[model samples]
Target: MPILKDFRYHAPVGVDEALALLHKSKKPLLLGGGTFVLNTLKKTAAYPTDVIGLRKIASLHGIRDAAKEVTIGSMTTLAEVASSPVVGEHFASLAGAAACVATTPLRHMATIGGNVASRFFWVDLPSVLMALGAKVAWAGDKAKKTLSVEDFLSLTGPEARGIVTEVLLPKSGLTGVYFRHTQTMEVDLPLVAMAFAARRQAGGVKDVRCIVNTTLSRPVRLTGVASYFETKKVTEWKADEAADVLRRDLEQGKLDDYRLHCLCADLESLIDKFKKA
Candidate 1:
């Protein structure tokens, strides 16, 4: 571990106390389980002196379901989320994704809010959350605000001006799947991932969303892929046609032919399985 200079640490018991500390502190960093932050500290010179731990705040934990939405408190652990019957029964994809994170020991120590707040391109939760159209509710410097997951991740880093309080996911007719591809069963992070959330429509596909997460940058929405499925029958589809279309239009320009071909192949296989399900 790196040597750190002496600094004040604060543990606030409520949202009001936490917000007040955030407003008053300079260059303060919020501490959840410290899985990421602490690891970074040991490897690099970066460490926050003013740490404001959110663990003391009873309000910022657990999963709760209302009639219309499911709310996950900011400090809720990944293990807790994975074990939640509400998540498993109602949000299978979310539960599966949480259960797959790191491992059981790490999941027990990590928080869902911390996972999303990392906003790392390689992380799986953000992409899955994007497909679910989750919204983040936080206490901003000026006032409380809620922003779409997309908007929240667009910040330079985690929002320094706000303390993320909860994540709200709308409940309704939505189906989702998360696929992680890696070279090894464990240890290796996902080389490429595909996440999808969509609603079946009477005529065809409705409200389809596709996201791609890479280790290079933040997770990106594959909107172009989703567009091809609109009004198209899920059963009768051409993977080649979809691949060719996406290959030509990606904003990143033409990917290496070999890599693109492999990605398309995986995509086709996954979609076929989803269609059958």
Candidate 2:
């Protein structure tokens, strides 16, 4: 590992300038907090030459609220998101996910954009967002477009020409439960992460979603697990029954046999916790 060769640096003052830089460069990497980039540069063979720092851009680092939804600027720090009163109150699952990310110092320096944009499959936010049915607002060449988190995580799609501007989450009547299984209580990557959100209609489960995050290529949705509870009484929740159904519903080879077994049990535990909580 060695220092990266001297390359041009662009610290755009605002979003327009940032977009211009992106449009002009053939290959430009957006630099938010630079936590992962800097580390990789030092320890790995992956390092980009042209770095476009978004830290100075004020417009890309705030939160906004409207009558129907909440918009979170892409460059906002994870720490800021964790402490956002609006986020904590309305999107408790998201806030909790942000708070549990890395650590106090890392969270303070890790931007939401970089965290979400990383290629790592175990990153927590995307799964939670997908489960929440959140949408990401992207600005590009032809025109701005928005994609649901699930779509954004798709394996093949149109390459986003510009950048992710903000994340929009609809205001809904739902409660969220997030569970991460780690090797220890200290800072460590999650072995398995589960997020569940349910909307109660007349005191019964009306809508439910579950997302499982791992080190694989992409997050996995336990559609079988979710479908089992739909239109059923929440009071009759049974972990063992759901696990049996999930074993038969999900793809047979998505995970290794050992991991598949563990994750199934984790999902069951998550459902039990949600029921108790």
What TM-score, computed on C-alpha atoms, does each candidate reach?
A: 0.90, 0.90
Q: Among all windows of ten consecutive residues in candidate 2, which has the lowest summed lDDT? A: 152-161
Model 1 residue 249 CA deviation in Å? 4.6
Give me the candidate number with maximum lDDT: 1
lDDT of 1 by residue, 1-277 (tens): 3565666899989988888887787767788888887677555444555788999898899899989999999999989988999888767778888888887788898998888877777787888888888899878777788988888888664354668899898996678888776657867566666677888775457788877765566777777778887757877567887776667545584445544555687669756865776
Output the lDDT of residue 186, model 1: 64
For residues 190-264, could you state the per-residue lDDT of candidate 2 as single tens digits? 767777787866646756887778657577777887888785666677777877776675564366665666667
lDDT of 1: 0.78
lDDT value, residue 68 of candidate 2: 86
Residue 145 miss distance in model 1 (angstroms): 0.6
In candidate 2, stretches whose alpha carbon ends up further than 4 angstroms from where it belongs are: 43-47, 155-158, 184-187, 256-258, 273-277
Model 1 bad stretches (over 4 Å): 43-46, 157-159, 249-262
